[model samples]
Target: MAYIFLDESGHLYTQIIGEILEMYTPTTDLDFRVFCDQRHLKGITRAQFKEMLRTRLLPLLPKGAILQIEMIDSTTNANIQIADWITGALAKYLEKQKWGEEYYSILKNNIIGEGKELFKDYWVEAKTNKKLESK
Candidate 1:
């Protein structure tokens, strides 16, 4: 009787864990772009952009230690106004696209297991290009 009880409990635990693992697979990659004039590229620096991400965005991760953000590509111009605009636009896009809510769900679910670090390593490698308008 004792052995049967232990076996059943263990099986139940294993099944629960399996169900959880199955629910939160790696999220799909997201990509979008916004176009602005040369005047918009005045004040944003790469360092400041990264810092903004770390402070404004990184906290959304469920487990900071396990989940990390790796930016593969980000292009910024020297204009502060442009930087601000870009930041605001990004915030708007994320909100419009339901990223904030999805991120919250990820946190609440406590998804990702042993391979979380691997997922983090490849999370957001963006590619960007800049074009100059000819008058």
Candidate 2:
């Protein structure tokens, strides 16, 4: 049995299943424009936008899901300027937003940091597999 921890940013979804992981970053502006146009927002607020994302995400997620969504306050930090630049570029190119600093921090601090031991274990396993293949 495998416990898959799923995460998403903008319209792109990432899935990490066992040792294999896949990420899809859409490459067309039309795709995002179509999505935005189809959403048919009647003056939708930011909160509504977030809620819509959560609702769409919920059904695709596994049962008893452990999901976290953090919104970074762009008004308070210099990092947000960098984030805005990234998002603006993405918006121009793909019509989507990238993960902001808060989410990035969560990944760096929580997932990656806590999973260091697991990463080390995988590193060892990978080395062992390579050695076996060479022998």
Candidate 3:
């Protein structure tokens, strides 16, 4: 899992969704299902949220690719709950909170990349991806 510093960003949903989606190759006839934890969105409607995802995702797909995105309450999903717990632990660890290292160490092996700042290399990388997609 990649650790992204998302603090006070209104576009947190996109970041989480995009990061997960970018992990896979967009192949023909691909059916990608992404489950996101529902949160109170400030400005956009739920429909707009889904559409925004499709806007970003569809460009990566070829002729025929199916993308399924669902926003569900975290309470109803055990997998989401585990993810939330892990996120919380990692956030605390990154923030250097009490017992952060101890908790982070438990799941250290699962972490892929650490210290990824959202504002720094993300946009550059996204542009690079777009360029790669065109070629």
Candidate 4:
């Protein structure tokens, strides 16, 4: 049997099932928008969130487990804070896997940049094709 943990926000959660470690910001919570609106006001920054995740997930995670982190899709949630948290989590996971700091930094930047570029391209294409109604 695998272990799973969830935070109060419900958006942030982690699970270790079999050989895979999964972390994600789930999109199904009805109160997620309200939760996001109150994010930093509660003094819970991305750093703190990352630490909380590590504290809960690390002990349960076995060595050589594959980490699968679900980053916020720009099309659905454009919150930069969530993106930052995902990047930080990725760095920690990569380090734990002994992938080296240099590789972590490179992957982090690519993650951040790739999403933005994809959103921009999608937006331009939609506009050009008149798929999105313009005001």
Candidate 5:
């Protein structure tokens, strides 16, 4: 399973890169130090970030791959604003991509009501299956 933690800075592009990097290289296992550089959150609009994620990152995933997205609302930051914008934009994008109903159903069935332990189990199971299938 691929885990993506998203946040926004001055420009959406930089925000995407920063967060993705942090996820791949964390400071400590429990450090929770990942953050977008706020200085980059100046002039860029959220719409641009959403479009970039859809056009760029979305295509990189294999067809039929499932994506689980989560946002960290840290300390009343502007990143929250960007996150909200991105969330809405993503919903719209998913609909346009014709993946709305199916994706939401999966999240509701597996992750939400069932609790995070189940989510983790599902993620691990999915990842293991993907790895085996690719072998």
Candidate 6:
């Protein structure tokens, strides 16, 4: 069993990445590349992020599947920039904005996976526990 310590984003990010990557598991010989937007990360160094991902990912990837992680600057990458726009549009759509609704309607059918809130109560429980500890 591997142990990984996560702070804030690492916890949720790990679960999300784990859920998505499980679909593309490669054997020990092939490399599976995961690209993440480094700008969105808070309170964690890139090294910590990599370690957090490795611990969770290594177990799932076996045989030919080598995990290759690239923490990229969203500003410089066109793909990442487009992704940021899509995310913004999705958020706006959720907020019931007209512009967002237009973009979202075009992309809605092409979206993949269930966007269920994983570990939804985790932050609430964590905050409550911290308050108890402080008192």
lDDT per residue (tens digit) for residues 16-86 in model 5: 45346434332223322234323323455544544444444444455654433333454467876765545
| Tens digit per residue, CA lDDT, model 6, 6-62 | 666665566566666665554554677888777555556777677877876788776
lDDT tens readout by residue for model 3, 1-135: 433345634357665667667656556657777787888765557677788778878888875777898988889999988889998998899779998998899989887885534556766798899999999
The predicted structure with the larger TM-score, 3 or 4, is: 3
Q: What's every prediction's RMSD, in angstroms?
A: 23.5, 15.3, 10.2, 15.8, 17.5, 5.8
Error (Å) of candidate 2 at residue 41 is 9.2
In what order do the candidates fall by lDDT, top score first?
3, 6, 5, 4, 2, 1
TM-score of every model versus the real structure: 0.21, 0.30, 0.70, 0.24, 0.28, 0.66
Candidate 6 off by > 4 Å: 1-7, 26-29, 112-135
What does the lDDT come to for candidate 4? 0.42
Q: List the residue pairs that clash in candidate 2.
A: none
**After superposition, which runs of candidate 1 have C-alpha atoms over 4 Å from their true positions?**
1-41, 65-135
Instruction: Assess candidate 6 and give its TM-score to the true structure.
Output: 0.66
**How does candidate 1 fare on TM-score?**
0.21
**Model 5 worst lDDT window (10 residues):** 111-120
Task: Report the Cα lDDT for candidate 1.
Answer: 0.37
Residues 21-100, model 1: lDDT tens digits:
33443424232112222222124443443343344333433443242333332245445455454455545555566465
> Who is ahead in TM-score, 1 or 3?
3
User: To one decimal, what is the Cα RMSD in angstroms of model 2 from the true structure?
Assistant: 15.3
- Model 4: per-residue lDDT, tens digit, 1-135? 533334433223322211222222322332211112123313345555444555544455555443332334344665856655566666576447555565566666665322212133765686677854663
Candidate 6's error at 20, in angstroms? 3.0
Clashes of each: 7, 0, 0, 0, 5, 10
Cα deviation of 79, candidate 6, in Å: 1.3
Model 2, 14-97: lDDT tens digits are: 112112111111222222111221122234444555565555454545565543443455565567666575546534443233
Q: In model 2, how large is the Cα lDDT of residue 18?
A: 12
